[model samples]
Target: MTAQANYNYSYDLNNNIFYSGERQIPAYELEENEIGTCEKCQSTILSLSYHEIDDEFIVTGKCSICGNISANIYGHEWNWISEIFISHFFGQTPAQTTEDSELQIPEARKSLKNEDNGIDDLELLNSIPMNQIETIFSPTEIKAMFARAKGEKCVRQYLYNARKKYKTFEDVFGIKIDI
Candidate 1:
């Protein structure tokens, strides 16, 4: 039997090894050799998951940029849960610099308010880290996402379409998509 198999065979503390205890360890574990990386922000991984199936590890997670599993992380399992939940489920990724979210807009301050002078998307875009940008999308995929953004009729039409590209969304959108 392989070392992995041996580990599963028994929980012999005498051997200085332990079967990730239920409470002490995460409910799930890594199964595959590697998982994809994040679609947004290449800084940190978008998701990392593992599961013990038939006695082995299946792990997956992505970088902030492509949601492509660029790196291989080996260690504790639960450590990544928090990050996955925050980024994959929610759009929030850990900020690089600590900009106060609560900063108040100056009441008297006005930004040369004019129709042509729109808010600087480029400034915001520049401020956005390369890692935060969503990974690229295919023309068909882009069309589907656009449909969803349009309305519920589109959402229903694209719901299954979205699921079909489950892995692709992470690759392009940098977000975990579960239908």
Candidate 2:
């Protein structure tokens, strides 16, 4: 079986949501300000498919006028839950970082405040030597490390769910992740 098949997740094209068993997970959508332009014929309509394991999106635009097909692959750092939840559901605008000041939403502002006060848990875990990681960090922190390594944002819900797989991570990595 493919590695992606091991994950019990599927996307609903009609509703634009992801499902892991019965759990409804957020899915990415084209932003109001964003436009999909077909390179070949300049068409505006496009069909997109997201590949979760690779964190890549395949965009296809078929021009009705010119009968030209345009396809592209977008990769790197794009996530469904984090992006959709913050941008769509919460109706929060993306933060803009400028030379003098950075404008962030309330949630991001809170996280920034916390980071300013002390080292982030994820950062600390990443800095620790691999040989000493299991010894230095707690099981939860270790799980967060694994999730981060897998390209997930270290959000609380993701971290909490990941912590339960501490044993699995330990077995795979041959490290004794402790509480």
Candidate 3:
């Protein structure tokens, strides 16, 4: 009879690694002829998997000697390899930069602000990060806010029509122009 070797696998979330007992055996290490090397132990086998969550791309794996390790490329730091991987694997276009989609305020919108109140919805939206803005505003409302901030014509009428099906601009966008 022939003997067999069995092994169990454990995953580390903070540092994505596959380990048995205390020894790390990342998938890359098992490759017949891999060129990548581990930075910690200088082992020529560190398996890595790419994951794009929200706004960050995380590469996780382990080394034979280092239990768990990972690297993160976030925001605009993504290189060509990461871009291609994220686009082809995740099927998502790279996220837009903060300045790329910023709302443009027209002089007309500036003149129409309630003279009694100095609140500018556009100004407020600009101050907060996009993540926070997304939490409180729906896509449609956000689009309308951009229009209103830019002093687009007929924004009041458009908002009036939208109010019937959705929350008021003040309630959704977290800025009170009338107050």
Best by TM-score: 3
Q: Write the per-residue lDDT of candidate 3 for residues 17-128, one digit (tens) a residue.
A: 4333345533322222332455445765443555444444434343445322323233436542321110001111122112322222211123224333343555444433
Error of 2 at 146 (Å): 55
Task: List the candidate 1 regions with Cα displacement exceeding 4 Å.
Answer: 1-49, 68-145, 151-179
Q: Pick the candidate with the highest lDDT.
A: 3
Off by over 4 Å in 2: 1-35, 79-179
* CA lDDT of every candidate: 0.31, 0.37, 0.37
Screening candidate 3 with a backbone cut-off below 3 angstroms (N, C-alpha, C), the clashing residue pairs are: none
Tell me how candidate 3 scores on lDDT: 0.37
Estimated TM-score per prediction? 0.23, 0.21, 0.27
Report the poorest 10 consecutive residues by lDDT, candidate 1.
5-14
Write the residue-wise lDDT of candidate 1 on 1-179 in tens digits. Answer: 11221121112111211223121223263333334434444255533444343343333344545322322224343232222111211121233211332211111121222122132222222222334333444445445544443332344544565557757544543333332
